[model samples]
Target: MDFHLTPDEQAFRDEVRAFLDELLPPGRHPSDPEFLSTWQRRVREKRWVGFSWPREVGGGGGSIMQQVILKEEMAKRRAPALGTCFMGLAWVGPAIIEYGTEAQKQRFIPDILDGKVQWCTGYSEPGSGSDLASLQCRAVRDGDHYVVSGQKIWTSIAMWSQWMILLVRSDPAAQGKHDGITCLLVEMDSPGLTVRPIRNMSGTSIFAEVFLDDVRVPIEQRLGAEGEGWKVTVSALAHERSSIAEVEGLLRKLDELVELARASTKNGRPALDDDGIRRRIARFETRIAAMRMNGMRFLTKQLKGEPLGADTSINKLHRAALEIEMGDLALEIQGSDGALEKEIDGGRWQRFALSWPEVVIGGGTPNIQRNIIAERVLGLPKD
Candidate 1:
């Protein structure tokens, strides 16, 4: 497939860049705690939150290619990502469009696009992580609502979110594991809903533990037909893959590492002068380039309306592994200073190293991705 962008698409890229140049905060760090609100406001101001969505849904109604261009430009600048709403705008929004009733769309779509409401995924529980279908969160039908009661762990940004797209067990017992599941749109303010932050090595509360105790959700809040949560989840995962769009950011980090190495001293000489360091940088650069190409291929398939399949797992696995490797290199370059808790002249690398674990475990574990590749891509037998 041809990899070049048409002139029109190139112009679109420039437009996105200029818009971001004006919209982005004067200075921001990817690790900043308040970065989410700042970036969310800018997205609202630019009206660029839902780039590829339909105009009727409070979006730009732009093409998929335009969306890809927007992500690339944002990454090139190393600007903070659009925050945890990535899932809301890309996955939940699209899912609602496909499966929600007209009233649901009218209520949620505008709030999502305007950044008035942030959302979190309530899929993983203490007992269920990769085996999501075996979730135990129960939702029993009451008079005018479903009374939900369970605990969700590792919910990203749930503490600050206004809503949660949750997967709960509507039927306690069914023939198959995937049966009896239902997707529910739950308001954070609902009675009996509580959020507790979980602190990570980065010294930040990036994820949370969400508790539901007889929380009532209206019948209309259900996303699709009952017992079809598996379908909704699969569709959400597809959108998750499309929205990751972080390959360019990874490349930019690699570029920063190169400059860091050039300036870093190792045994009275620049780290770039060290043979081992040079080789490591070269390998990272090569892998990052391959990742960019892989991302482009994924985008092309998406443009052609082809299914993403297990290839998304491949991308996730590679990208997560590379992030850890880059973090490792950063730590090595900093030597003893890498272990520092706060920013010293050269100690901030420790933060990068500490944050690597989250990237690996966040979207899906590497082992889980491998399982998907084995069963779906290679057509291997399941254990």
Candidate 2:
């Protein structure tokens, strides 16, 4: 893939930089409610909120390269995200756009773009995480509604989200486990549905164990046809596995590590002067650059209108390992003090140290990604 940007791409990058200067000036805090509100509003107004979606559905409909340019500029500036709804804009909205009825689009897309609703995915279950098609969350059709009954674990943002893009066994007796699944757009407040938050190692309650006991969902809210959820899942998961989204976050953390190293002393000398520390830092930066290139490859394929496939697993696996490595390296730099809850940077490093699994094992485990790469991307025979 060509590394050089075309003239139009360069101009677009300049445009994004200018937008940042005006709206996200240096020292701006994205966490500030007023600033964040204003920023989201401005980006939404400029149609950069959902820049990759179709224009007819109130999206910017920007080209793939343009989207890359936009995200790159924003990340370089450490600016806030373009939209507030995380899962909504990333995969859920795209899935809806692909398989949802026209009425569903009109009903859901606008809220997603405007960040009026939060969406949580309901794919993983007690029995079906990495092998998602084996999910047994039942959703039996009854008149105009489907009665859902089952449980999902490690459901991120389940307690906070207003909606769930759920997958269930709508046809339990179908020919295969993969063929019996169906996707549903479920409301969090529905009767018989329960959300019990799980306190993770990081001391946060973002993940949850969700139970659906005869939760009635209108058939109209079914995301795709019965027995076709496996296809929908495969497509949505491809988006989930794209590691491009994690690039900016890793870059920011790398910057923090660099700063920490400069301030730290080892053997009565600056830690930055330690050859070992320098090498580890360099290794991280190199890996990050590689992930960036992988991201570009994904973009390149999209530009050519090719379907994204298992190549995304390469980056996904890299990102999972990187998150853990980065966290461990940061704590290593802190030495003995790293173990204390509030030792370095008010325990930010400690929090990061404990937070690897969410990224490492969220979409798919590292082992799972490798299997995908070996068999699907490399054409290696599966044992």
Q: Residue by residue across 1-383, what tens digits does model 2's lDDT show?
A: 46888999899998999889998777777789998889999999999987889999999998877887887778778888888889988899889888889999999999999999999988899998888888889988899999999999999999999999999998878887788888899999999999999999899888999999999999999988888888886777555524555788798899999998999888888899999999999999999899988788777787788977777778877788789988898888788898789967899999998999988898879999899889988899996
TM-score for each of the candidates: 0.91, 0.96
lDDT of 1 by residue, 1-383 (tens): 67788999999888877876765656655566576677777766566777667787777777878777777777667666553466688689989987889999998888777666789999999999878889999999998799999999999889889899999999988889999999999999999999999999778888999999999999999999988988987877666645335777777678878887887889999998999999988887777677777777877787788987887777778778788889889877877766666544554666777787677897679998899899999999998
**In model 1, which regions exceed 4 Å deviation?**
20-47, 79-84, 241-244
Number of clashing pairs per prediction, in order: 0, 0
Q: List the residue pairs that clash in candidate 2.
A: none
Runs off by more than 4 Å, candidate 2: none
Cα-based lDDT at residue 211, candidate 1: 99
Error of 2 at 349 (Å): 0.7
User: What is the TM-score (0 to 1) of candidate 2?
Assistant: 0.96
lDDT scores in order: 0.82, 0.87
